[model samples]
Target: MTRRHFRLLIPVFLVAILGGVVWFQLRSPSAETIAAWVDQAEIALSNQQWKESERLAQLIADSGDREAAQLIAGETAYFEGNLESAFQTLGQIPLESRWRPRASLLAGYAAFRLQQPYLAEQLLTEAIESYPKEVDAFRVLSVIHYDQGNLRVAIEDLQQVATLAPEDARPWRQLGLIHRDFERFPEAEQAYAQAVQRKLPPVLEAEVRQEWADVLVRLARHPEAEAILDAIPPEVPMTAERMTTALAIAQVTQSPEQLDAQLAQAVKQFPRHAPILRANGVRALQRNDPESAVKWLKTATQVDPYDYRNYYELAQAYQRANNATAAKEAESEVKRLQALLTRLTELSEAAMDQPWDAAVRRELATLCRSLGKMELAKQWEIAASRCEQAR
Candidate 1:
């Protein structure tokens, strides 16, 4: 209770108050600082820098902005193909939060990717309720309906997306794919034409053109398809499908010399490509060179035994070479492969009808593997895994 003790206590109180102020300043980030961090995170996300965006999201989370942080984290995970983590993180964002609409859309997309079509449909419906003009939601909903075999509903959803984003070619491209898969060649050609008219990245434009050309070929518009194919830039890398399409067009529309030159180029570029090898063999057979035809046809069969067309062509080459027994054996092989291909088509239709059936998807993977479609086999395997998880 002395005057000196009172004076020491006052300084102690002042030091304690000053320390509290400093601690508060250190603990709470300014609103402007948080906004800046958010901007940087979004920029990183737009640029596809997933790790950097996640790091910034963590910083934002530490600063007590959990919703924005969650959205950033979810988006990064989604872009990185971590759909489960994306769905969980995005679903945690509250409906009242400013980030809710975007979160819901992404979460719905994640669910769809995970093969939970029913849940994804509900979530997307909710998101569209919140953001009526959500093009991405509508686009994904179209895909979900397509997978579920609701073709009419899928087209309706895609039309809505196309209406919402008139300048985007992706919706039309999707429409084209749907029609193409159903063998509606005219509708596919029209949709692909629309897609090609819109703005697209160069690579995507080339791909779209290629797809359009394929549809044109199916429609027997050989001249138009050849013109479209010729318009594509030479620098674009030719995928197997692209080369196959080119060969198909060349065989029908080009002179024999031109067809031969194109086949040579294709065979040089893809020495082990089964389709090109078969085309070469067929050309040789047409020229009455049975020995060369037999050699190329045998190579084609070895390269891809599952393609019944190769076996059929080999049978023809064997007959031309007067090998009756070999021709009969090749014919039998063709019949067996054609039966397998028919079964594959039937199973694919079954899969589209029963989206929740993991067994159908697993069978598809097995069949695709047996047919030498390793990439498609992997995709079917992944789809089966996702289907199982959804169940």
Candidate 2:
């Protein structure tokens, strides 16, 4: 199979989700609005009588009281997973009065859910500006920035959410991750520690601790990170995530023997995992045993070529072994990965971040030259330029 494509999503570890949402409830209750609409709709909506509610909502929308019945219908449609209709319907309500803040916030999130990033940003920013106390609007804006790879800005925006609602753990967790990526270890440690203090369960605490370990590893405090890893019984849940942490530490520290031991332990526990097998190849690669590494990486591709990076690693192994022919075959598969890295590079420049994407492309382009494929180098350069243009 030809592996000549280049792309990458955020790495699983680095890509953190903002899980806990702290929605702001206005001190002025909706009880007054609900009272106004009681005759047309009801005190509460029943899922079974959706059509009744929709009809009543249309009447309320016609009456122009901002009663929120129509908004309820739209939100219901969204909750039911009728995404397109929900977006279309939600956009029509004129939320110019008291409900404007809530309406704009929901509309922003709906646009985001509909995959219209620009509209989402516009609507969410409007909501937050109109009602600076509306915490959810900042959360949604944080998402828009995060998807565009503006992690520092994303963290900045999420921090606004915490400032608006200081008791929320979600923002702290998110801030912790962004800080970790930026190598602000003390800040990351403190943010994550605050998240832990918020009484996140033992299960999630372990996950957060694993994140802490990653930050510690980057800071070259492997021993402290390892202590966190050692606290959990190996028999508990999140074994794969735990193993991934161990592997990262060993790989980063160039402890091939330690890596080998971790892989061996993981294999005994879960022999069939493709990642475990791939980790073995990585361990061998670290030790400068290219041929030996290929023995495992090839198996990894055979099991799952869709991963893309496995083939890239396999190509690296071939190059290291000095088997140029085999290396060329593997190198051919890197185009897609190259394209992806090139795009990431462009996005980074546009966001005024580091030029990691460009650096990655140059590295890949250099490899193409090594394989005597200058056309590939030019293609990558063009891709890089396109990214820069987008930036």
Candidate 3:
């Protein structure tokens, strides 16, 4: 109540205000400090220190660096395999922002992993334009081209990737797979050899060797195939593909009695592998045992309904067993699947090139629906709408 007491209170109030101001200033980092934190976050991300990056993301967000927070969060989502979240977060970054190129690159990969190839191609193209030396974008683009059945363009993309990263064996291994799938045996062999020369990890080396052996078997280089198989360590597990390749070589090199034992062992080891069951069906058919062939082939079809070859073999087995109705049904499936594959290949090529073509996307959606790829069908339907809007 006294005037002196009032004056003392006034000074205390002013000091309290000054102290509050000082605390606020200390808590709120400067723009430059926020930028430095963003840089540190980026470094943590590049080094794959995910927890550190996440910590920085929270710090950056607290400091009002929303875009930098989004970048870190997007990358974390991507590494965590939350692809849609990654794409959404990364895609929200402004195109003109300095961080956009990195965002686009990661978002592009997320789109590709989500099977939105058209969107992936668009974002990857933008990323490539901004950062021409980025090898991962080119590698993913190559796979997209391969999915389109544009093998030449895919090869070109891979060649660019190889030029950018010569020590990476993955491109050579991928090239081998493509050639093997297309039945270009000699090219597959050469690519596999190149991959081997690059000194792959033990597991990958064994896989590559098995594939190379399969290619050799296709080329009738039985001795070489056998040698390649022999080179694989006994400790490695026998995968279905490896088992199939061994069987192929056995059929060529072993006596009938030995092959019978091999087939029985393969079936025992990989009881549910469709290729092994199909092999058994083919062997039974060769021996004129239609009932056994029908049993094995039917199982193969059940195991892998998408493989047309199973149905094709089943049709033969059914026909030989005098099951005309079942034979016709299997044959019909073969024809349907074959036609679906042909049309899908064509439309995929078209869609890859004409990303704005709503008609192509709709057709793809319909095809996917018929093939029981319901998830892919839904994606294609959504993409079709985007295509229409883009147009």
Candidate 4:
């Protein structure tokens, strides 16, 4: 070969060698290097540096660190609201791996977030069986059952959690909520009392106290309810809800003149409040002042047009006043509203099977408007609107 040709070949050979070195550096990292990367990713996650953590986690996964990589990737996807990806990623973790139980728990959570309660139940049950000590998995399984309308099963799951973690106030609180939902006031009161005895955050403690007071009122133990309400610290301002509870206590415990004074104060404080207005209307009816009842109830219907109870009360007032025409009209409205509520409930159940259906959401909004659930109606309307916009 000529000298000039040889020089050119040497330069090309050197370039190839450099390219090979670069490729080697970019290949799958060693086990030690991947472990170090995993540590860095965990630190980034702890610091809430999500983007850096995601990048590092992806790098580790690509380097063949499947167990830690999939776990971190799934968790990152969950935090980022990528539910399907999170579920799929976490499901890839082998059952033999130490991370499997946690992966199953997270995957179940992702399924629940996706509104697949049945799948969540399945996954969570498996996780519970695999790691009987996982309190969080049991808790989430209970919530899934509750959301699916399996109240009995939900209660049973919570009982298991209580047995497993007796010191945890959350299980007791959940039991109280379930009892309250079923209107088992005595059971609710007992559960809430137990929860109150345990360690709880201040806000949660206040909520439990309020709910317990409500149960006391239901049992007609007015003095007990009042004591519970009075114990709430001054730092927790008397919200409209607390005011309503206070009014209930006064209604049961106070004399006529004192009740009137309390009602007047409530009206002055919460002018235009629907519950207070409804209370006044009911009181007028009980006093046999049909004319006054009609007047107050009419105003309430105007202020909160969707409450079926107000229409029913208005009908009774009209009947008492011998206004047959007005009574018939109000009664008809009550029946119509009741029928609409029933239809909406059926639609809501059906929609649960097809949660992304915009038509169902729109129908729900219409029904909610007729049932005095105005805020929920607005939410349904917004969801329908978003679906339409996406389309």
Candidate 5:
């Protein structure tokens, strides 16, 4: 600790301090210039002037206004479906910047679009925790939580989002989803009803109506729900869809042979709708004439192997009828469709408490073993593992 050494260290310490200060100063944006550009770019985006917004973002990006530029660029790139690039670009924003929240939020969404679930989670969590007021983070977080089969967490995440955007129809839609996942049939019905009442866009409103009807059927309140739908005649005369709903109600209520009679009428009217045909197959399942159901649904699978419900019901029918050969075949188709549905439901957690998912998996495993397909049974055992995790 000589005086000479101390004096020499002071210069180095000052240099280090000065360099740190300069680095921080350099990191901050030119607020006036960035703000002007941000305003202009926002107007451009609102007016659908993508070209102008893109140009401004690129111009600022080149000038080292990294945070602002990255935010705008990510938004524009998302518009164009260049999600990977948008995620990478937006993720580069310095952590402490004011625009960092927005950048992280955008990056999370871009990562989701690019199918990078873990990355989406990390980025979105940071954005949400840093800016709890931002609804965008909650929206993305809800999906992430749902995909992991944590429906409770998903519900909590979406609740915050609903509070943040009470007027938004999306919140009500998400609320319906939470209720459905938990098998809270009555709550789901009300949530979807609210979504419909919110003056949503027509297409979305129609979808809400369908969802409401589904929850009603689950609650065994079929007649009331169908009456509600019947009151609102479809914009395009969707008698076919209404028929399918009616058939669904009959199936749920066990209104003896009602579905059978409806099927004949359905075939006479909207004979082409696969859903109606599938309903007929389901009615056959209820009749204890599994062989007839198997015979009919076999044709159904041939016509549409991708409809998992039909295939699953058909497999159940074959099993009930003690036709090991046909049951195993139908079940193989069920597995393929289940795998596809799992992939599609990645964000929506399509597997979580989905009524038929676990039943189908368990039956598939059982059928494989009964049919002497030991290896297939083992594969289905693995599928059962996945189904448990989803719950």
Candidate 6:
């Protein structure tokens, strides 16, 4: 209402307007400033500062450079476990761009995680074609083929990866795994040998050595297998599977006294271990100590009531000890189990007529052993070995 008050408010308004103008000028950075931001974003990405990289990438995109920003954003999404977003973002990169190969690889990986195998294969194939030396692309493609049950193709892809990265032992180790799964023991042995020669990390070397020894065992090179097993460092914790394998190797290579010592140690460590108990019972029977056999076999049966082999072995022990009533009871249990095994026996017999049916033969061998027919079990085991050799 007064002229003096109006004049004072006008000066205040002018000062506020000048401050606003300065703030706007500072907010809108120059082109050189944005370029520096982009460089910093790239550096952040290289250093795996995901949050800062993503924020700077968004700023770059807002400043009108979208391609690099999108690439970083896509990769960040992937590392953050946003598969769908990563796929969508990476898929938007133009095919002719230099970053398209990387985009395709990331998109392929996202598709694989999303369970879209066909799309993954398509994208990965494109990436590999565009970037032939990309070892990761080949590795993922091999995994896909392996999962799809195309073993030969998987092996070929892994072989290419090995050629591409000769100093990397992973491809050779993976090849050994595939060969071992197919029962191609000699091929597995060679692959594992290559991995070992390449000098892998300690954990991986131990793993490869264990698998190589297993292959040797399958090939009936028990002495070499035992040597390999013995060389495993004592520091490596013994897993149940490794313990079982060690027991088997000992049974084949060690004298009775040595075997007894190993069995005692195993039983002490694993009190409820049915296999060790069964092995002890068998060892007693071999020494013509039927009473000891009965004690061990009874404990084995109690530990693993479902294993018909224990019952059958118990019957033999009772008969040897002249316990007619106990032998009859155990024999009755064997008959019951035999009835349950009849259908499996029929299937195995049918498979026997087919060429190279190792799985069925092995199953039949196990079943026959439980039936107390060692002769038949041995024959089936031999057939299974022949089938494995053929593979």
Error of 6 at 246 (Å): 3.1
lDDT of each residue in 191-306, candidate 1, tens digit only: 99999889888788888888999999998898899898788888887777788789989889889999999899999999999989998999999999999999999999999888
Each prediction's whole-model lDDT (CA): 0.86, 0.68, 0.87, 0.80, 0.73, 0.80
List TM-scores for all candidates, in order.
0.69, 0.54, 0.62, 0.66, 0.54, 0.58
In candidate 3, the residue pairs with backbone N, CA or C atoms under 3 Å apart (3 or more residues apart, or in different chains) clash, namely: none
Those runs of model 5 whose alpha carbons end farther than 4 Å from true positions after fitting are: 1-93, 96-99, 109-115, 143-152, 174-178, 201-203, 239-241, 250-261, 270-391
What ranges in model 1 sit over 4 Å off? 1-118, 129-132, 142-156, 235-241
Each model's Cα RMSD: 9.0, 20.1, 9.4, 8.7, 10.0, 13.7
Query: Which 10 consecutive residues of model 3 have the lowest summed lDDT?
Result: 144-153
TM-score of 3: 0.62
Per-residue C-alpha lDDT of model 4 across residues 273-385, encoded as one tens digit per residue? 76777778777877889898898888878987777888998998899989999999999988888888779767766655654467888888888876768887887776566
Which residue window of length 10 is worst by lDDT in model 6? 347-356
Q: Is candidate 2 or candidate 3 better by lDDT?
A: 3
Using TM-score, give the best candidate's number. 1
Deviation in angstroms for 340 in model 6? 12
Tens-digit lDDT string for candidate 3 (1-391): 9999999899899999999999978898888887788778878877889888878888888977677778888988887778999999999999888778889999999998887877888899899988899998999999776655456678778878978998888888989987887678999999898888887888889999999999999899998999998998898887988999999999889987888889999999999999899989989998899999999999999998988999999999999999999999999999999999889778877875775678888999999888767887887787787666544
Q: Which regions of candidate 3 deviate over 4 angstroms? A: 1-137, 140-152, 355-362, 365-369, 372-391
Question: On a 0 to 100 scale, what is the lDDT of residue 295 in model 3?
Answer: 95
TM-score-superior candidate, 1 or 5: 1
lDDT of 6 by residue, 1-391 (tens): 7999999899899999999989767776676766677568657865778778878877877765576668778877887789999999999999987668878988999988886665787899999887899887888888766544345667888999999989989889999997887679999999988988886766667777888888888998889887876777888776555565677788899998998898888878777888778878988998999999999999998887757788899999999999999999998987788785775547454553553567877877787777656886787776577557545
lDDT of 6 at 286: 87
Candidate 4 runs further than 4 Å off: 1-89, 94-102, 109-120, 142-153, 161-171, 199-204, 286-288, 340-366, 374-391
Give the Å error, residue 211, model 1. 2.0
Query: On a 0 to 1 TM-score scale, where does candidate 2 land against the true structure?
Result: 0.54
Considering TM-score, which of the candidate structures 3 and 4 is the better prediction for this target? 4
Once fitted onto the true fold, the runs of candidate 2 whose alpha carbons sit more than 4 angstroms away are 1-120, 144-153, 176-193, 233-235, 250-260, 270-275, 282-291, 301-340, 348-391
Local accuracy of candidate 5 as per-residue lDDT tens digits, 1-391: 9999999999999999999989877975577878788778867875789889878887677667667777787677766778887777777778988888778887888877765656777788888877889887788878766654556777788788878987777878878977886678888887787777676776566666777787887787888777666656467345676677777876665456665776888868986677777777777777777877876777776665557777888889878988889878878877876775454345234334442255555665665555445675675565455556444
